[model samples]
Target: MCGTANPCITLCAVLVGGIDGLENKLPLVAGDCQREVADLSAEERRGLRVTTKPHISIDESLREFQSDGALVRGLETPLVSAYVSIMEE
Candidate 1:
């Protein structure tokens, strides 16, 4: 969560097409959620940021997920590293 004057950013790893049986469904859900948030005006959004990994999987371990070590890390990471990088901007 962000403070009053700062923007609120969220990092997510969208695990779609996994054994969870929600194959391809989570991406749609994520899209819908993003749309809802996008409906807000710029001022209302308050610099909101939403980062997602649409093709990730439930089978991925922490090391596997972060193997690329991209800004978009896995959920297992205590700190959403992407947030820190974006906030620095």
Candidate 2:
């Protein structure tokens, strides 16, 4: 969690498809993303979450997304490695 000042999970609401919804939207499951996301000090991955709704192992889902289809579907955006730039001010 990024603290009350920034509730990142709420942001996940609209991301899931209307049908697939949370199922289709890729979330940080396990491995480095878990620690990496927790270690983040804001302005990193603003819209991050630990989702179990999909039921798929975190690592497997993530690895599946590491491919090119994830890009074509717009499910895998390039915001993970980069810092969150949007400002609330």
Per-candidate clashes, comma-separated: 0, 3
lDDT of 1 by residue, 1-89 (tens): 12422222222343312322353244422222354553556544544433532333322423344454432333434454443344445
lDDT tens digits, residues 1-89, model 2? Answer: 22322244224323433324356664544333555444555544444433333313544433443443433244335542121223221
State the local distance difference test value for candidate 1. 0.37
Cα lDDT for residue 13, candidate 2: 22
Against the reference, the lDDT scores of all candidates come to 0.37, 0.38
Q: List TM-scores for all candidates, in order.
A: 0.19, 0.23
lDDT of 2 at 51: 32
Q: How accurate is candidate 2 locally (lDDT)?
A: 0.38
Q: Between which residue pairs do clashes occur in model 1?
A: none
